[model samples]
Target: MEKAAEFYTLEKGILALKDQIDALAETDDLDKKDRIAALRSEIEKEWARIVPQLTTVNIVQIARHPKRPYTLDYIAFLFQDFMEMHGDRRFADDPAIVAGLAFYKGRTVAVIGHQKGRTTRARIDRNFGQANPEGYRKALRVMLEAEKFGFPVITLIDTPGAYPGIGAEERGQAEAIAFNLKTISILKTPIINVVIGEGGSGGGLGIGFGDQTLMLEHSFYSVISPEGCAAILWKDQNAFEQAAENLGIRAATLLGFGIVDKIIPEPPGGAHIDPEQTFKNVDKHLYQALKKFEGKPVDELLDERYKKIRKLGVFEER
Candidate 1:
């Protein structure tokens, strides 16, 4: 994981000011109290000026911040009565991908997401949010069950990529992801996908197909992570900044491409800075998205989904 200091070098001065504000908050001196207020105003002004000009690589860093909320964090804040389901039946349960049923605003829905655990040991256990074939299979099982009960499926996409270990390939990782793409494309139940963080490669796309796709303002979705792309294309991982810009992985860029149905604004400085507000923003958009498919006919929903998928990458040669 990249150090917060390294990735946030651009905000070094701002962070130092924040540290001063934190110190002032603990004191009861009148002068310190006034200083706190002044610092806050300065911070806000700085954020307004800096956030608008953040480069694509800067946004990528924010998206992958270790402190940023993950799939389980959002579930805790946004859902109720979450009963986690485990295993693919054919193999062991993979901790990297979580799948289950939950109550969203009193409505039952299936939830699936990539889980990159917080602690070092946990991250290793979760394979750094890289799923194997079994993990994808587990997700498919829950999604299919959602369809059986006519419940909507909500998937959170945040992964660097699928596990590329030989064992995963032997178990058919590529085939598992392919199966999910085919099944989700025509599933009878409504589907909503949210890119809360690093939506990278086929790992993100394994459960990414849906009627509506939403992305957090500072998050990124790409065919490959910038570092991986840089290594492959430029033969230098240090060229990630250029790769990020060329990939057009930002939420605003994807929104322009019609790949993202909506961009849920994050709090200033990114989601980790104010996760509660970020959760609320995501909740409001999710509710609105669900309402759009509330009473639509199955045939119409399927037709629209097919058209939407087909419309991607359409271009004309002059």
Candidate 2:
């Protein structure tokens, strides 16, 4: 359903228009043909306006746009000499979460992200991009390695959420995520995180603590998904439209709330339309964000990070 070929939003409307066209073509009446043409025009106009202002649920599907740039896609485009590291040492390698040594924009950086495979087989193989506890642990280990080596860390978050299955819970999913947050808090290397798609719940929190947290426009982050919130708050799953509005999950909304540092604008028609352009924009911002702290002292950077985190709920009583 999150696949790329389904990128166009007006598919259903367009399909109806096509069906009308076919029906009119087979009919004996010229009046039916004229009606079909008028109907097509109306559908086109309505879709033109709605496509750009797509809803959060619609965006959720688009964020997973099969054609969207995945971690591996961007990695190959922006980095070279990627030697993929494997496993937590305590467990087997996890494909859902990919952490490895990479040369990014001519600098050696340890990179990690949720890796959703491209095809049906790939999705099943990747567990639909949901990382298990072991995966998070492996990612934390790689980040530490990057810090120890003084190499910057680049974390890309794009998941519905951490795996919520019984197996993951048995292995301590919450503790594994907490370990990442704790590790990232004091890690010496400059860390940069980008919410390339759906940065859902704790799965994102684990990798999201960074000097700069960026989000892609049309992407979303949420404590609970719209459907989940609706099911709990309204007692009806169909109230997702209202629930999405209340969630404050959009990238622009998150930036307004200071939850994200910046919003990376995607190409018109969505990121799936021109991933190359999206990648370029991301590359530029990342360069600026990385350079901002490149020459700064580690202790000062550490202080700045702590201050950034602490500023979240500061208030003044008048």
Best by lDDT: 1
lDDT tens readout by residue for model 2, 1-318 = 332344454455554665676678788885986787786576567557667667776777778677788888888877788888889988777899898998877788898998888999999999888899988999998998998889998888888889889989999999999989888988998999999988878987788768999888878888987778899999998787788888889887888878899999876556765578788988988888899977679999999998888788647999
Can you tell me which runs of candidate 1 are displaced by over 4 Å?
1-4, 13-41
Which pairs of residues have clashing backbones in candidate 2? 3-66, 4-66
Count clashing pairs, candidate 1.
Answer: 0
TM-score of candidate 2 against the unseen true structure: 0.84
lDDT of 2 at 194: 90
lDDT values, one for every candidate: 0.91, 0.82
